[model samples]
Each structure stands twice: as C-alpha cells, then as structure tokens.
Target: MPVSPRIGLVGSQGAYGRWLRRFFEQRMGLQVWGRDPVGDTALSERALLEEVDVLVFCAPIRQTPEVIRHYADIAAGIERGQLWLDITSIKAAPVAAMLSSQAEVVGLHPMSAAPKSATLRGRAMVVCEARLDAWRPWLEAFLAASEADCVRAEAEQHDRVMALVQGMVHASHMVQGAVLRELAPDVGGLDAIRPFASVGYELDMAVMRRMLASNPAIYQDIQFDNPHVAPMLERMSAQLDKLCDLVWRGDNVARDQLREQLLERSRDYAGKQSVAEGSYAFERLGYLLADLREPRFISVFLPLDRPGSLRALLSVFEQRGINLDSIHSSRSADGELLFRIGVSRDGDATALQDAVRAIEAEGIGRVLEASGIA
Candidate 1:
C-alpha cells in the first residue's frame, strides 16, 4: 500500500495557512499538520516539523524572511527526502532560502485568491522548478486533486511578472482609493446624481473594494518588495505629464503624436491585431501586440454630476456581452464627463451601441464619442 504524503503547513492559524490546510485535507486526503509561528498552536514547531514529507511555508510576505531562515535551519536537520515549499507572493527571498536549505525545495505561487470555499477550479499554480524531476509527480498530483493547472516558470521571471501584475493592479486600486477618499467628504451631492453603473465601473469598483478590504501591511509588503516599482512609476509619471501637457495646453500635434506613440507602444507590447469590439484587453488572447490592433485612442462622455453613471454603462455592456479593452475616465473642463474604451475588432459593436442608447434613455450616462476598433 502506498503511503499518503505527510503535509506540514507553517503558520496555520493565519488565513493563507488555514486556507491551504483545509484545502489539502479535504481535497488531497493527506495527513496534514499546522504549526503557528506565533507559538499559538498546541504542537511545538519542532515537533510538527519532524513528521512531514512536504513543508509549505505559508506565512505572509512580511514574515517570510524570518520564517524562511528558521525553516532553512530546521530543515537542515531533517531527513533528506523532505521537500520544502513556499506559497508566498514574493518569490526571490523565500526561493533563495529554500535553495540554500538543500531540502529539495520548489517555490509555488497560487495565482487565485484564497479559494472562497477552497474549490480550485480554473486556478493556476506557478512552480519555480528547483528540481522538477524529483518533485513533479507529487506536485502535479497534489495540485490536480484541487483542480488547479500548473504553470512552470522561473522564480525571477515569476517575480518580474508579479511586479507588473500584482504591483500595478494594487497600485491602481490605491490610486482609486485615494481619489475616492479625497472626494468622499464633499460627496453630499453624489447621491443626487443618477447611478451610472457599467461593467467597467463595476470592475474598477471591485478592485477598489478588494483593495480597501486587504491588509495595509500586505499592501506595504507588495509595494516595497517589488523592485520594479520605481522605474514603472517614473514611466507612468512621464506619460501623465505628456497627457497633461496635451489636455491643458491644447497641444493637438503633441497629443496626436503621443497618441500614435501610445498606439505603437501598445502594438509593441500587446500586439497589432485590432481588439474585438466588446472584449476587454485582458481577454485579448494572442501575442499581446499582434492581437491589439484597435486605434489606440477612445473617449466616453457622460453627465458631469454622476460618476457612478460610468459603472452603470459598463454593466449594460456586460448584459449585452461587450468587452472593453482599455478604459479611463475624466471630467471635461465644461462639466461634461468622458470615458475612453479601447475595444477589439471581434468585440460586439452592436452591443456597445445598444448599451449607449440604454444609458442615454435611462439618463444613466451621456456618450460623447464611442469609437469602434478599426
């Protein structure tokens, strides 16, 4: 009879720890033990450390260094066949520690939010292969049980992508939060404005809500741990300055040139294929640049009084199966609102028209210019 894998989860009382524990126990049918690093567990860390074949360091990113050092030290004394793993978002530090530990370690980063009920359909597990030949079977089997697809990538590569993915996303949320908070105190008249709900608005709002709900410490860890933040922020600032110059100074030529440059950049980065009329930039499946052929500029106009009106318009698109490739909003100098959506060629243009009509008829929003992807 085959032996079930012995699983040890460090910092089990914490959310991610608990999430992994319950998931493995219920799905993988493994004998699992959890050790709270805070010393809150009934079992001693050492005692629990002794019994597992695989140890997952699931502590928060901030706690990762100490946890990694301690675990590396502990694993040095353990048996040779044990595999050490970490499920933290930031990969470099823990991957280094695990590599130095000589415990046949592999780094894993789960891309999904902690499974709402721990059911892992359509989730992705990124494995930084230290020794895939040795650990692949077990890792594949374990993740398979939870219905997660495995994506193999290098540790540094994973961190690089994450710096853009998680870092940029959370930063956007933070910026939105700041904007919202700045507007909150004077929002007395906001309620009087019509509700402008749209799929894009809901998407942004969802990001905002999730960021608001996340721990500040975690956000700080993400900001500081991502070494890519500085250069990226600088580039973003430069682009903003260019846009400001165009908008405020009436630099049409510069604006047009900048717009073309942006389109060229999008093609270089996202691909040259026209974005389908209704699909989001995210769902644009292909070479990033080759697949994104839409003219790089778009503008949306809405009534100035209701910012939420944008959200309602996006919701209408959702109902009609339209996708927005790139989107941004701003209030015009004359008290009119504008929304810009970059769409794909295959995206449903008729749906966008219907949504626009609905928004206008319901007094939910005003469309200043709705340009279709060429």
Candidate 2:
C-alpha cells in the first residue's frame, strides 16, 4: 500500500490560508499541518520540514519572497520527492526564491477570491512550474479533483498580467473612493445623492465600496509590491492627460476623431479579427442608436389628487410580463407624483408596446419617458 502525502501549510489564519487548509483536509481527505505567524499551531518549522511531503506558503504577497528565503535551509534539506509551493499574486520573485529549494517547487495562484465552498468547479488556477518534474503529477491530480482549470504560464508572464488585472484595477477603485471621500466628507452625503445618480454611477459606486471595505493591506501589496505596476500606472496617467486635454479644448471634431480612434483600439484589444470586421465607429453606432429607441422601461406621472392610479399602472406592467428592476416614486412641489419603473431589455417588446398604448389610451397618467437600451 502507498503512503498518503503529508501536507503542511503556513499562514493558516489568513483568508486564503484558511480556505486552502479546509480544502486539503476535507476535500482531499489528507492529514494536514498548519503554522500561523501570530500564534502556535500543530506544526513548527522543524516538524513541518521533517514530516510533510508537501509544503505550501500562503503568506501575504509582500511577505512571500522573504518567507521562502527564510525557509531556504530547511527546504534544501527536504528529500527529492517532497514538493514546495507558494500561493502569491505576483509570482516572479517568490518563484525565484522557491527555486533555491531542493524539493520540487511550483508557484500556484488561485485566480478567484477565497474559496467559500467545497468544490472549486469553474474556477481557474494558474501554475508556474519552477522545478516540478517530480511533483507535477501530484499537483495535477489535486487540481483535477478540485475541478479547477489549471493554466500554465511563466512566472514573469503571470506577474505581468496581474499588474493590470489586479494592480491597476484595484488602483482605479481606490482613486474613485478617495475622490468621493474628498467631495462628500459627511457620513450621509452619499445616501442623500443616491436619488440623482445614474444606474452606471450607482454600479460603479457599489464596486468602489466593496473594494474599499476589503483588507487595505491586500490592495497595498498589489499596488506597491508588483514590479510592473508602476509602468502601467504611468501609461494610464498619460492616456488620462490626453483625454483631459481634448476635453479642455472643446473641439468637437477633434474629440469625435479621438473617440473613433479609441473605439477602433478597443475593438482590437477585444480580439476582433480586423478593424473593418468590428469597427465600433462604423458598425456599432447604428445598432446602438436603434437599441436606444427601443423601450426598456416606462415612466408614468400621475396627479397626487388621483387615487388607485399607482395600482392601475403596476397592473399594466404585471399583465405584460414586464419585471421591474427598480421603482422610484417622488412628489413634485405642485403635488404631481412621478413614478419611474426600470425594466430590462430582455422583456417582451410587444407586451411593452401594448401596455404603453393602453396607458396612453386610458389617460391614467402621461408617459414621461422610456429609459435604457434594448
């Protein structure tokens, strides 16, 4: 009978570390050991090195390189069949440190947020193999059991991609949050401005809030620790300056030309075959205009003096299979009631048309406007 591999995890108290520890013990049914930086665990450094067949470092991104270097002597002493891995967002530096180990080393990055469930189905895991000749089969088997898509890439390539994917993206959210705080220092200011915000602005604010609420150290590590982030930020700043210059000049023709150029570039980045095949400037504007003309939602304005009017308006939408995404009712100074109903583009067009015609025919309320695109 074959002996089961003993797995050891460092930084077991962090979010990703806890998730990984649970995954290995419960899902893989393996005997696991853990070492937490702040407290004592079942395994000390010496015990981990001596007993475990596989060791995983799950420390913060900035701490990973140093942690690997600190354990170099112990890792070098591990047997040839033992495996070593580090789960870090930026891979190049830590992968280099892990290469010093005599054990088969591989750098792994889980592309999604922390694991919340037992299975990792439909998630992506990036693998940068350093010296995995002896451990590749074991890594593959574990990933297969977890049902994750294992994508192989070089360490430098992974860090380059993460510079944009994590570093720049998080930086944008942090900037937005900072701008909002500067403009609205009062606690209830954001709430007071919600009614005037557009759907797109609301969505952006929600994402910004989520990002700001997460662990600040994570974002700090991503922006400051990634070697490629500074250059990417410089490029973004240059582009922003160009856009600001074009807007400040107020040259409509020049702005339109710039917009077309941006659209072409965006299509290319999105993997369109050719500029002619999917040119947003030439092909998409017409479709976009047509879509705007299609009714996405109906707004009904009724006099406050009239009763049962709100009920009648809702019945029309209910009978038409129109699901309301949002509904806001506000009263004007003159006692007129403004009711806005948001509907998705996926709803029935004929039903919406008939409902609108019926509402207009009955004169229950005047249709103020229709919003969104089909």
Residue lDDT tens for model 1, 16-76: 8878888788877778888884655776767777778888888888788678788677656
Note the clash tally of each candidate: 37, 0
Span of 10 residues, lowest total lDDT, candidate 1? 284-293
Stretches > 4 Å off in candidate 2: 1-3, 185-188, 271-374
**How many clashes in candidate 2?**
0
lDDT of 1: 0.71
Q: Quote model 1's TM-score.
A: 0.70
What would the per-residue lDDT of candidate 2 be over residues 154-273, giving only the tens digit for each residue? 999999999998888888888888878888766467877776765456657877887777788888998999889999999888877877777788788767957876655777677756
Residue 348, model 1, lDDT = 61
